[model samples]
Target: MARAILLRQLTLGPRSRLQLERKLRDRNVPMEVAAALLDRFEDVGLVDDAEFARMWVRGRGEAKSLGRSALRRELNEKGITGDLAEEALEELTPDAEEESARRLLARRVRPFDRTDPAARDKELRRLVGLLARKGHSPGSAFRLAAQVIDADSGDNVLEQRPY
Candidate 1:
């Protein structure tokens, strides 16, 4: 029964062993059965936490522009922890994160193009907040936001001297 349940779940999508164990628990499967089934699944490569973590990190990072911190939190929530999660996160380099942040900021600030200073400032704050929620540092968010806004405005606001 546990095997059937596990196979059915796997047919739907890849799941972490922890998630499968929880599902077994929720279904009232005996702990011993759950453990045996999980071990077998692992043996057969049907339940690989490391591969799941890697795929989760890649998919979420690309689809949501999530940073390392956010990705770590997500992996933890999905019952992926410790070295596997760290290894997956290591796949995302600092440059890749910064590039994702830049893309996020660029998309977010698109509507504010040609707006006045006050409105642009307001939008900038919102964009920074979005980045913050995605687990980016404030400094990185602000720098990226400024760079995107400057590029959109066709002026290097940071480089201009006030008359």
Candidate 2:
């Protein structure tokens, strides 16, 4: 019965072996039974934290525009181990981070009226807040926003802004 539930969970989504064990415990499945089921799943390649970590890094890095810091934190929260997390994070490059930041900035830049000082400040603040929540650092969020807002400029765009 516990194995059936475990199989169902796997069918729904990829799960780390540890996460499955924890959930099985919550369901009041006997420890021995849960361990046995997990072992069986591992043997059949149904539960693979390594593959899960890899896919997670790829998906979140591409879709959500998350950097290594954000990706590592999320994977750790999901029970990924340190070594595997490092390997996965190593696969992401600075270009990936920049691209994600660029995409986010393009969408967020319009809210600020570039012609008005106060409006620009307000928009920069709002954009900064949005990027911060998305897991970018202060320097990265502000710098990327500047680059996106002034793609053709030689001057520092943030300095020209009122705020």
Q: In TM-score terms, which candidate is top? A: 1
lDDT of 1 by residue, 1-163 (tens): 8889999999999999989999999999999989988998899899999999999988888889998999999899889888989999999888788777776665666565455998779877888889999988889888777666766353333233222
lDDT string for model 2 (5-28, tens) is 898888898888878988899899
The local lDDT score (0 to 100) that residue 51 gets in candidate 2 is 91
What is the lDDT for 30 in model 2? 95
Those runs of model 2 whose alpha carbons end farther than 4 Å from true positions after fitting are 152-163
C-alpha positional error of residue 153 in candidate 2 after TM-score superposition, expressed in Å? 11
Query: Model 1: what TM-score?
Result: 0.88
Model 2 earns a TM-score of 0.85
Query: Can you give the lDDT of residue 116 in candidate 2?
Result: 88
What C-alpha lDDT does candidate 2 achieve relative to the native structure? 0.78
What candidate 1 gets wrong by more than 4 Å, as runs, is: 113-115, 153-163
lDDT comparing candidate 1 with the true structure:
0.83
